[model samples]
Each structure stands twice: as C-alpha cells, then as structure tokens.
Target: MNRLAYHQGIHKFFMMLGLALHISKPVWKHLVHLVDALTTKRFSGTLTDVHHWSFHPNHRTTLSHFFTKSPWNEERLLEKLQEWVLRQIERLAKRTNQPLFLSIDDTICQKTKPSSRATHVIQGCDWHYSHKDHQMVWGHSLIWLMVHTFTQAFPFAFRLYDKKAETSKMDLAIEMLSSLKGKRARPVYVLMDSWYPSRNSSKPA
Candidate 1:
C-alpha cells in the first residue's frame, strides 16, 4: 500500500474502535486525529506534538477543547474498550487453546514537588515509592491490569491509587480483577509481584 493509504487505514481502524461506544461524530473525528498523532512514528507524546503531526483540520486549541469540554463519556469509552479487548483476546485464546493471563502492576507518574509558597499542587499528587528509583518520589501511583496471551497483550484497565480513599493498592488490584469475574472465556492466571499477594488477595475469589 502507498504511505497515504497505510496512514488512512490506521486512522480508520482507530475510528472503528469508537463506533460501538455511541460517541458523537465530532468526538469520533477528534479521537481519530488524536490516535493518529499519538501513534505516529517519533511522536513526542504531547498535545502540541499531536497538533504538529495530525492531518485533521482542527486547530490545536480545538483539540485541547475536545479534551476539556467534549461531551463524550470517558468511562463509557473505557468500558467499551475493555469489552472489545475481551472479545478479541477470548477469541484468540479459544482458537489457540491457550490460557489467558491477567497481570497487575503499579507504576508511579513522577511529578515535581511544588514549592512551599505555592498555594496548590496537582490534585492526587503525593509521595509514592518507586522501585525503579529505589526511593520515595512525589507522584501519582497507577495500578494497571493487562490481559496477555502467548502472542499479544492488551491493557485492560487501570485505577489511580487514592490515598484519601483509604484503599490500598492491593484492594484496587482486587477490585479491577473482580470486574473480570465472569468475563473470561478461558482459564486465567493472575500475575503479580510478591508485594501484592496478601493472605486475602492470594486466595481465588
């Protein structure tokens, strides 16, 4: 295929992802542009970078507004994404007669410590231990659940570790896993480090 056709195909695939979610046409249009920009080779991973790489006619400010004020429901989008991913992975597992894998892990999104004089810091930013840095760092911790097969993997869900909620990372992991209780079509294994498997969490629920 020619370069333009290949790019168009990729964008079309992204557009199809939201079709089942019942999002507005404008939101769908913006989503394709954003996905295209993000998946571009050498993407710098910023909205401005998206503006530079995107072929859509909307201005960067319009894209920014889409994020801040768009009527699309993010939770619905995630739910539909999970539904689509589950369908795909289940088909692969059943076809190959392979067991599915559910992997749970947490990572810190490091952030700069605000100055004492500063009135407010980013909401949800706090100190979290980073195994990679081997020290406590100021950031938000995210718990992620991924589904893996012998051939491929997909991020299934995620939760931000909320300190004020009085919920531990293990609890968040369990909650996400619980969401998959009756959803799997094959034998599934849960993978995690020693840090997450408590007496309660270790048991099959």
Candidate 2:
C-alpha cells in the first residue's frame, strides 16, 4: 500500500504510457513521485516528499500545476487505469473461488483553504451534509466503483457528485453499472451499505 510496492511495477506502467503519449520525462517522473508521496505514510502529501526524497528535484509549485492545469484527459486516464484493474482482477479470479464483488460508495473530502476553493466550481466541491461529521462540510462528494475478488479491491471508476448537477448518489452508482455492462467481468454481486441499497438500486427489470 506504500510507495515501495507500487513504484516497482505500477510506475513502470505509467512511465511507458507517458512516453508513448509524448509526455515529457519530467512529467512522467512527477507522476510517479506524486503517487509515491500520496501513498506514503511517512511524508504523506508534503511537498518535500514529492521532490521525492531528493530522487527527483523540482519546486513544490510544479505539483499544484500537475494536479490542476495538466493537459491530460482525466477521463481517458481513468479508463486505462480501470482496464489494468480489471485485468489484475481477472488474474486473481483464476486463483480463487470467491465471486467478484462490485461495490459502490461515496464520501465528502472537505476543503479547508481559500485557494483550494477552486474545486468549488470546477471539481464539484460544495457544501454537503455529512452523517459522519454531523454537519455540512465544504468539499467534493465523490462516488467510486470498485471490484473485489475476495482478497483485494481495485478502484474502477469515479464520479463527482454536484448537487447543482441534480444527480443523486444512487444515480451515479447506476450510471457506473450501466456503463460497465457487456464488460468481461460477470456474476458481479452488487455490494452496498444500508444507505445505498433499495428496490431501485438495480436497473429496471
């Protein structure tokens, strides 16, 4: 779950793809270092770690640009990530009898800064009441689709829920399910907490 394990293989995947897509080597290096810092428990989210233990040298300002204004198709990148996830799940399925689980859930990641307010309009960040915190919080409400094969879970897709967009959390889950139809994974049991399950949870009969 930390940088060491992921950097061994996943970083290589990103590097090769970045090269094929004509991404600058620096961008590719930052991509790996960004993920490394984010997943690391030691220096998590600190700018110093992203210079990557002095492995790659760059200013902290670069990360802000990499996250917000990077000229890449996020949706396409996510699709490729999902493809890799599915392939791994399929490989794991061959070794286990456990049924594949497709789970849907969401959370509010509250933003606490004025500059971070950019997410307010652009990335679906807003005030949403949180049962966990017992009050409204300013942040993005993001829902995810993940696949599990008994031993592990892999994130497949995501949707940012904007109240102004009029899409309910349940609706976002259903959209992911619909979009996944005709894919290779089958016999996927839908998993959810009490808040999400309903007679309408599944597609129309």
Candidate 3:
C-alpha cells in the first residue's frame, strides 16, 4: 500500500479502537493531507490548499477551531499521544530486553527579524566559527530532546525552543525525563553533546 493509504488505514483503525472520536472523517482526511505536506516539505502548497479546502462548504471544521472557540485544551491530546508512544516503547523493551536511549541537544534556527509572539527574550550568541563569512552571526537557540526507538535507529522526541529565554537546555531535558519517569520498567539513558556538558551555568542533573 501507498503511504497515504497506510496513514488512512491507521487513522481508521485508531477510530475503530475509540482512540479518536469527535473528529469527522473529512477533517481527519485533511489532517492526513496536512501531515503528508509537512513530511514532504511542501509548506507553501500545503498551507494554500489547507486554507482553501478548510473553508469550503463540504469541508468540516477542524478540531483546532473548536478547541479555540470552546473551553477545550490541547493537554488531553498531548497526553494521549504521549501514552501511545510510551506503550509502543514498552512493547519494544519487552521484546528486545534492552534499555531505551534518549539524546538531548540544542540548535539555532536563525531568524533575521524579531516578532512579537516570541517569548523568553535573551541575547543571541555565535557558537560557531564562520570560515566563509569570517565573522559570526548571532541567532536564537533551540533545545531538543530525542528518543531512539526500536523500529528506528535514529532519535525522536525533538522539541524546538524558539523563544529567547534564560532557561537552560538542561532544564528542558530534565522536564522531558520527568515526564517519562516511571512509565517504563527498563532503564533510560540520556546522551548529550559537549555543549551540554556539566557546567556551573546550570546545576548538575
């Protein structure tokens, strides 16, 4: 089967298992389209099509709209996704009899201009030597935490920190660890690069 079909099948299965409800089939289909667009890096086309298709007469309103208009929040959806991921990891741990490894790192998504929505304001710094430009350019920093899955060799669980804040990447890593704590029987080993080495700037974890 094709990728789109596989995604649709999984969506149907989840719906049948009662894990996804209150979301119409059409909205779900659009959401799958959105995911495909994101995966394929077709951002402009996807945004245009989503905006056009969403307002059509036959298209149903998305869950995001309802939640924003009503009292519902994203916490429940996030919790469900987390639970599903943990369950999958548990199954893998039982099958392999090995501990799970998580990697934490941070990078800069450089932006030339500032926006009002950005939070945690902090001064930009240049961590790399630009040989081509002969000068370093300051940019905002982003921290991420990743998990290595049994099905995939690479790390997942990447979180982006776009805001300019005083919070250390270590703090974010600890929060992610705390969330996954007690969720598995096997051990979890977190790896970090030299940028995240034990430092006086932040207390040891």
lDDT of each: 0.81, 0.70, 0.54
Task: Please give each candidate's TM-score.
Answer: 0.83, 0.74, 0.61
Q: What does candidate 3 score on TM? A: 0.61
In model 2, the clashing pairs are: none
Query: Between candidates 1 and 2, which one is better according to lDDT?
Result: 1
The alpha-carbon lDDT assigned to residue 36 of candidate 2 equals 64
Candidate 1 per-residue lDDT, tens place, 168-205, comes to 88889989998885756699899997868766543121
Error (Å) of candidate 1 at residue 89 is 1.1
Q: State in Å the error of residue 142, model 1.
A: 0.6
When summed lDDT is taken over every stretch of 10 residues in candidate 3, the lowest stretch is 51-60
For each of the candidates, the C-alpha root-mean-square deviation to the true structure, in angstroms, is: 4.0, 5.2, 6.4
Of the candidates numbered 1 and 2, which has the greater TM-score value?
Answer: 1
Model 3, 1-205: lDDT tens per residue? Answer: 1464656665765564444564565545555555554445335543455444333233335534632454433455455566666666767876888687777776554444445586754455433323344654346455566565555434334444433455666676667667765655788777887646566565221
For residues 1-205, what per-residue lDDT tens digits would candidate 2 score against the true structure? 2446566665678754444375556566677776666665676556767666524457778877887787756676666677677778877876686678888888777776346445445355678778798888778888888888889998888888877765678888889887675656446788886657676543210
lDDT of 3 at 126: 32
List clash counts for every candidate, in order.
Answer: 0, 0, 2
Ranking by TM-score: 1, 2, 3
Best by TM-score: 1
Report the lDDT of model 3 for residue 130.
36
